[model samples]
Target chain A: MLTIHTKLISAMITQSLKDHPIETCGIIAGLAGSNLPLRLIPMRNVAQSENFFMFDPQQQLQVWKEMSARHEEPVVIYHSHTGSEAYPSRSDVELAAEPQAHYVIIPTCSPHKEEIRSFRIVDQMVIEERVQIVRQYQPELEFQMMVA
Target chain B: MSITVIIPTILRPLTHQQKHIDMEGSRVSEIIDHMDQQYPGIKEKLVANGNAHRFINIYVNDNDIRFQDGLATSLRDGDVLTILPAVAGG
Candidate 1:
């Protein structure tokens, strides 16, 4: 299951809508071995196609190096589906090389409705998972409730 | 010449879970061949049709080999070679 902050989801949704009709992709990085995604980093879709998305080779290398230096990993790899439903396409499964990442898809096909779905595409198998959007992470639950 | 290769998570199994490997080569193709000698199946994962697979990016010292001579891209000692699978889809 993907347990993420609402702010990150909002950012992803906004990016998806902003780049609608052209599939946009990015990754949310976090400390290595920590499932908690902390920072959202958007990648330019070099393909710039409504049906396809690819990261610029130079940018990808740079970002990956930075992540390694920071001792982080891409916890969530996200993209948008402009022409179809929010699910892994044939190409999506073929291109899923990061088995440890949460493949999140934002569907902007409908103008009035917005949806976000997460999946685990490993070894060409797409397994949908539940998303738990929280206002804040753990360790402050009682304090958060009192403040709320 | 010794080239340091930073392997990604997916390819770590082939490297015996070694995050980074040092091998001897003067060019990108030679390095790949040397790696294959040690790790039998990793070459096919990185190369296809005599070229670096389109789905993977091979960067030598922050510059992608594709912008150079591809598999024939020259390399020097102490250069950092990083291989990352492309995060792309339709």
Candidate 2:
């Protein structure tokens, strides 16, 4: 079971959904610590989509290099379903380049139905996992809330 | 009592483009009932005939109601219910 820093990722995803509600996508950068122990950081989102999120090869490489510089591993690649269920389509599984990366799906089927779910897509197979969302308010967001 | 329900982006079309709505209820279930009375097919998407939808989650003041009373979760004045869509990308 993979635990998610719920509030942090949720905020990122909420913004992504609203920003690119049509087809939002991004990358999750974090430590891959395990019994094996992999420490990584400097998470940045490399937003992409199948038909809508094609990034230039150079841009992709740049992001990967950035990840390397930060010692962060590709823990997961997330995108929204956008008016559909949170299950991976055949195309999503076929494009699972990172067997180690968890393919997270954010279903924007209904604004009133905000739910976040994660999955692992490997070898054209989808293995679902539960994520624990731990919300820590960004100082800016906190201040805004306080002021309001 | 009547409270306002905020619908997320994905589910807005179903709500006829109205982002915010007012409904009457003492509990979450009652609010849902009031919404169903206003919009015909809404409750079906929210509560699967009997149980809540597998993909939908209801939050009151940013706290997930699933950890609370499910549909029976109580509501009060000035309370905000944000209907968030389950997002799966990253």
Candidate 3:
């Protein structure tokens, strides 16, 4: 299962709507070993295709290094499917190398009624998981969330 | 001749869970060859048809080998080479 902030979900939906027809991809970074996503990072889709999404190589490296510097890891990897359902395609499964990250697929839809889904794709297997939406993070973690 | 290579998590099994290792070589291709000598089957994951795999991005310091000289990109002492699987899909 995946638990994410409402603000982060809104950010992703806004990004998806703004980049409609062109796939959008990004990651949420959290403290390494924490598994709690605190930062929402929207990446550039270098592919810029309606059906494909690829992060800019340079940007990916920079973000990855920053995560390392901050002792963070990508807890959630997300992308938008403009014309398909919220599910991983065959290619998505074939290319899923992050076995530990939750893969979130959000189909372009009415942001007010979006039904996004999360999955764990490991070794060609795709297992759907539940999503827990929380309005408020722990008071202690709220500071980090605001800082993000 | 000593170059540091950073391995991604997915390929850590081939490197015995080592994410970083010092290798000796003059070119990116040679470094890969040396790594393969130590950890069999890793070369196949990074190279295909005598070229870097399309799904993998290899970097020498801050420069991507694809934008430089592909596998022939020269390496100097203390250069850091990083191998990351492309986060992409259809």
Candidate 4:
């Protein structure tokens, strides 16, 4: 399962809507080896095509360097489907290099009630996963809720 | 200089499923050519018509070769080279 903050989802949705008809792609970085996404990085879609998206090579390199310096890895690799459902295409599954990453897709076909989904793609296999959206991370609050 | 070439998942079949290969080369082109020698037909996937494939992105130690010197990008000992394919976003 993939757990992410509500604020991050909002930001991603906003970006996706702003680039409707064109795909918006980015990575959420997290502490290396932790698998917890905490950083939202919006990247340029150089392809600028309604059917495909490619991160600007220069920007990708810069962000990757920064992540390396901070000892972070791309925990969540996200992209938006402007007119399709929140699912990985055949090409998406074929190009999934980071097997450990949570592949998140947000569908922007309709402005109302967008559906966000996550998946794990490894060795050309796609496995849809559950997404847990949290307002905030509070150990005590979580414990209290569990008890109640 | 010894360089580490990171093979993307899509091209791993050509490299016998190896994710990375250590080779010796001082330039990006030379390393690619050497890789072709080791894994025949691999270069065609990364390059086409005397240039890096449009869908392929090559980076050296987190810096894009296109922004630097393309195929002629200079390399040093222990440099990490990453090759990845451009994928659909929408």
lDDT scores of the candidates, listed in order:
0.89, 0.59, 0.89, 0.82
- Candidate 2 vs candidate 3, DockQ winner: 3
**lDDT, candidate 1, residue A101?**
93
- Residue-pair clashes per prediction, in order, are 0, 29, 0, 1
- DockQ, per model, reads 0.91, 0.01, 0.81, 0.43
Interface RMSD of each: 0.6, 13.3, 0.7, 3.2
Against the true structure, candidate 4 has what lDDT? Answer: 0.82
Ranking of models by lDDT: 1, 3, 4, 2
Clashing pairs in 1: none
Quote the positional error of residue B56 for candidate 4 in Å: 2.9
Candidate 3 displacement at residue B15 in angstroms? 1.0
Cα misplacement distance, residue A115 of candidate 2 (Å): 1.6
Tens digits of per-residue lDDT, candidate 2, B1-90, equal 767887744466668879789877878888888887877777876887565664465776666677788888899987877665333232
What is the C-alpha lDDT profile of model 4 across B12-38, one tens digit per residue? 889999978998999999999999999
True contacts kept of 3: 0.62
Worst window of 10 by summed lDDT in candidate 3 chain B? B81-90
TM-scores for all candidates: the values are: 0.94, 0.48, 0.96, 0.77
A139 Cα displacement, candidate 1 (Å): 7.8
* Clash count (model 3, backbone only): 0
Flag the better candidate by lDDT, 3 or 4. Answer: 3
Task: Give the lDDT of residue A82 in candidate 2.
Answer: 65
What ranking emerges by TM-score with the best candidate at the front? 3, 1, 4, 2
What docking grade does candidate 1 earn?
high
